[model samples]
Target: MTNKKRLELTWIGKDKRPKLEPRILLEDVARSYHAKHLVTDNDIFDNRLIFGDNLLALKALEQEFSGKVKCVYIDPPFNTQQAFEHYDDGLEHSIWLGLIRDRIDIIRNLISEDGTLFVHIDDNELGYLIVLLDEIFGRQNRITVVSFKQGAATGHKAINPGVVSTSNFIVLYAKNKTLWKPNRVFTARNKRDTRYGQFIDNFDAPYAQWRFITLTQAFARSLNLPIRGLKKAVGDSYEALLSDFVVANAPRVVRLARPDYDAVSGDARSMIDASHKTSEILRLEREEFSDMFFVAGERILFYSDKLKLIDGKYVAGEPLTTIWDDLLSNNIHNEGGIEFPKGKKPEALIKRCFELATIDGDLVLDSFAGSGTTGAVAHKMGRRWIMVELGEHCHTHIIPRLQKVIDGEDKGGVTEATGWKGGGGFRYYRIAPSLLDKDKWGNWVISKEYNAAQLTEALCKLEGFTYAPSDTLYWQQGHSTERDFIYITTQTLGADQLHALSEDVGTERSLLVLCSAFRGNPERFTNLTVKRIPSTVLSKCEWRHDDYSLILQNLPMAQREEETLKKKKSAHPSLFDNQDA
Candidate 1:
């Protein structure tokens, strides 16, 4: 066999990736209702609830929101071969991989450099999902795999022998590890103890409380310096220098090792030796000290002084570990008052993710907005959020739940814990239809549904330009660079029209004119590049078809069927979707 080098997870169709359309979002004002109380002077109506397929929704968000989102928490469907009430959870292994892979790729683009992504999944696909994530986010960017306890015990444990699982996994990754920094979290103080109640006169009144920490044998040995002159002054002068150094340099907590007498061999022996050396130095400094030789076995002490004091107790907040056991259960019946039968993420869980990953007013996105748990939690936590859900529950569950959150009528889940007397709102939006479709002659053309403004904006996005229309210049729809602009129109341009446009455009800048047809021949203008509209945008992305999820069966045939048939007749076979054709 020939030696291959690419280290990645491969499936049946691993090489195939979807060419997603950068669709536009259209706000549905009729369905989009917000409470008056939630609207404050600082309130921005940028919070969105998109009702459509998440894959398409992510694509729609790409151009405007690329590298803008601060956090993403998704609870995608677990391939458990189980049927869900709103969505089908079961899919073929390869098809499931393709669907998730496509969405993951887009999500990676949507997150900022310092942003984080949390994927909630079960054991059924955990191994494969981890490998896939490692490939996309890189193995180094993979933060941790947290095992969240789902419940105390399940009936399945009785039937399945020996080490049955009652937990789900949350895989966390950052877009860039060097820039990502999770917020420090503190739990409620359960006990009160003052073991290291040392006071320093050098520190100010509010910051007087401090704890003493002993230097570890490893640390002492690592220093490899004499301890003789290190402890010249004990009380005032030493405290001043150490406190100043710690405050200025060591902002985080410093850990020191406790001497272990039993394990005094190998590396521990070096620590013991360093301790004896330090004791000898102290003995020389303080000549009148009693039992100087006998005290050599004692571990050296080092003051940390960086401990936080809250309610008369020094708080060393327990850093979040890989095993998360205290999060709320997903099986809560009345959570957010939306009884989603399957895959409803607990509000507490999402709240914890936000607390660690983002601050207030940061943009948070949840493409898999099941039961709107992410939205409810994000809103109460004062985060700006955008949630997308494909199923009909977007109306039945997500909207009502969010409305309750805005009205301060929601009293369940993390409401009491977060002190949320809610006051925020999200505007509802639906992904617009594809911009381009094939006509009866099988020629690519702009869809009839697009108006002049919509067509201009769509063309700008397709050509990698920023839409910045000016009333002074009617043809100035958008611009790519400061000197390069784009103009879009549906009308066929004749010679006089082209000459007028070129004269207005001038030689100082360049312009790309996208029209239905152009009649100017022999490279007359140097600053203008005239191109046809639909033909130019046709090969840029997969158009006309919306949904990209992998489902075994179609949803219930209702009024949506007629809509589907209409789309099918207009849509042509793109490179990505030609497998069925």
Candidate 2:
């Protein structure tokens, strides 16, 4: 009999190798919501909530949204070594890195030139994640690290025995920092409180009583008047006389005012007198406050506090700093170190980021949308959004939450505190399946479930083509470039089928088709360029063989102590360095 140990070793070796086609990691089916006769319809709004793999969904979005998004906020899996209830939560550190690497690479491509990206992470992988972000987003594109309080309690046993809680990190990266800035709108309360201080607005001076001063010396100088011993003659009313003299000189000239306009409207005069009258007025002058004003001699007119009624100019203050003071952490109930549920995000967090980095009507995209928080907040802020989620939670949690927001029923600090009362709607979509599949001859054939036209549309979406022709039955999809049309075929096309496809492609123009065959006639289809399948589609999938596990396997076999030290060194070069190598 063969040795059992050798057989076990062979089995172990076989099991350790990666699979070619891994099982679908996160799968949740939903009914079709947008596609009508293979073209976008006006019935569907610009905003979207996609329930599917984020990577695949991003690929799908390439057709409609690449380089169009203005802001993106993603709180991806932080590889915290904790189990996740929704997915294969725990991955080897290297595997996690590889996964994030691919996803971030695609995300970087999706960002417009003026777009910004905000990523939330914990201490577990923050440094490594930063390095990865630098590699994908480029070091020059880094914005800032916004620190947020995660939890303030450390369960009585602190690592330092003094520090009680921990803070989370948000790493922001922009496509081009110099090209754009976030927009801010001041609140009416802040304006009234003057807590932001006395800054100029429209170059107008403050309308304080001191600014409208009545000078006795100036009055005496006017019309050769003398104020010598004026305290005896005019008494306390000397200043009032000066003011009345200035008012007579000024005369409240109404350049553009209607000739028939009346500032002495009976109702307005009564309201102003009633409101300004005080106990001091009653004590000083027995006459009512209304009767005290000598309207005939002085040009005194009651002015309401409303700025709209004034004829003054305003001056702008210093531009606001993009960083906001609000945090979204409150009552976040979860055991796996995840914040909120799979389909919920704190509104305050999104509001802060948007207010700092984007303007109204900017496009916001969140790929790993555990909850539809980003979309909801973007909607409330008057920005458009594209949300991608890859779990059943997208339907049960995200859809209902967004529906509540749309119907004005949600009050979870989002609608009530933020004052968001549903004004727009979103179109929902599920990631369409890949169009191409191998046949007996390893040849490309279109799937029967999809007609030629449907296959053409799917190919277009897969290959970054935004539109397809409805009138003609051209096998190729729309042009991304002048000579290229996104083309896809399920089975290998034979010589005759290739000729037919070429003839349909037309002789006048060349075709850049993405297919499963390169054996077509070069002379007849001289302008045609063929990109094979699997290569085109695999880039959009989380191919595990190309992921972190393979990277970790490259490391030489070493003792546990050495491996730990290596990881620590990689994680924190600032902490550990110059020790004996």
Candidate 3:
């Protein structure tokens, strides 16, 4: 067998991986906002808004949300991308890729088999990000890259000498390409269609007696002007005048399209052939085919069929395309009732993501919450959502904006369009602090911050067990399987205590006992596996380490381990503390 050479994006610290702690969420009751009364029967009250570092947040959600989220969208910081143009081997660029790679790996596991992932990035890191995602989600699972026209160069930007940039990109990928099926969607078009050039003179007449005329002639006749005098009459505004006429008589005007020989459906080809010979308009009578109109071998498309109802007005629309210039970002400053400076994304953009990949009630996740646009849009669209943010704005901005959405008082950005009368709610949670801390002697130990329950749960997560303590059995604090159990405690267990625990475990069952100390003859207890706490967990993770940061606004310095030890030595001159076991 031959080994395959593969291409991948490499950076400093790319090989070193983080063993993220599966930290538990602690909800703040006062911060979690909800509607006073239910306004709709489908009001969702279980959405989550997490305040913490996003990478750790993703790890915490891994166990319960793995392979369950239907859609995942993240918009990470892109300011560091300024390094890409200069081609400097900057540490910030490497750190950006490293942190983003970590989040993407975790997110891939969180998405369902049929789910999709959308990463919003600008052009600077877009190339590198595509390669990274291709490696994680497989090159075959890549769907498309959308070029979003966030704004047009105007105001101060217009004075710039060189070409101005206004486009950002959204890279899309499926968790499993074979199982993923995306919904077809249409977006509002910025311009009207000019293809409906033919107007049926007697549109309501029977098929055999129908008369067709060019739209220019029809427009000229309406004004009692001859066809030759039309161009001189309307002059430069002729196209605009014809467009207005087409909109008014949209159903009567038609565009003639020839059917592709090989690609056209069997029924359509047959219908086109029969119509050409009979010289009559035909309607596809087959129930299996969509209702279609054909005249003399050409498919007839009415201007009315392209109409889309948008913003309380019927306008032209087309299939959603890779270039998304129609989404305007002009007045986004006043939206969401909060000011996030450069971070907040428009809700309509996220709503389109939901329309493409999910339905109402599907679960959506955004690890980089960044002004909480994903959660706010998901809430209004009736999708359950989870958002993670480490910034203080998680309170100052996100919670208040979400409160307005819940109270139905927010009347901006898709709210009026969706008919959202609010009535949904989200729970607020913050990531729990680390479970282990170092002693003054530089020895690893259980943190004093954890209470008994928190300690047991943290240990359960580390040991790969479900934390479900049995009410009847004190020895069963957690379990990996039906008959396999784990028990943790701070007390020392002697030979007699070990024997008692083993007898209770019985011969058919097995138990992992994690205690401060255990004493026994090696071959005595067949049912129990004994180990000491702190020691068993010491090598499993980067214990008590805060060596890195996910934010890449500037070059980061690693937290000095020696400095930490010195500080701890000064704080605790005596090694033994009152809580020591």
- Superposition TM-score, candidate 3 onto the true structure: 0.84
Clashes of each: 0, 18, 0
TM-score of each: 0.75, 0.58, 0.84
Q: After superposition, how far is residue 529 of candidate 1 from its true place, in Å?
A: 1.0
User: Ten consecutive residues with minimal summed lDDT in candidate 3?
Assistant: 81-90
- Name the better of 2 and 3 by TM-score: 3
Each model's lDDT comes to 0.75, 0.56, 0.84
Residue pairs in clash, model 1: none
lDDT of 2 by residue, 484-539 (tens): 56556656766677676777767666665666655756456665666666566554
lDDT of 2: 0.56
Which candidate ranks first by lDDT, i.e. highest? 3
lDDT tens digits, residue span 416-529, model 3:
877888897999998878888878998778899898998998888888888999999999999999999999999999999898898899988999999998776735788888
Better of 1 and 2 by lDDT: 1
Instruction: For candidate 3, give the lDDT.
Output: 0.84
Which candidate would rank higher by lDDT, 2 or 3? 3
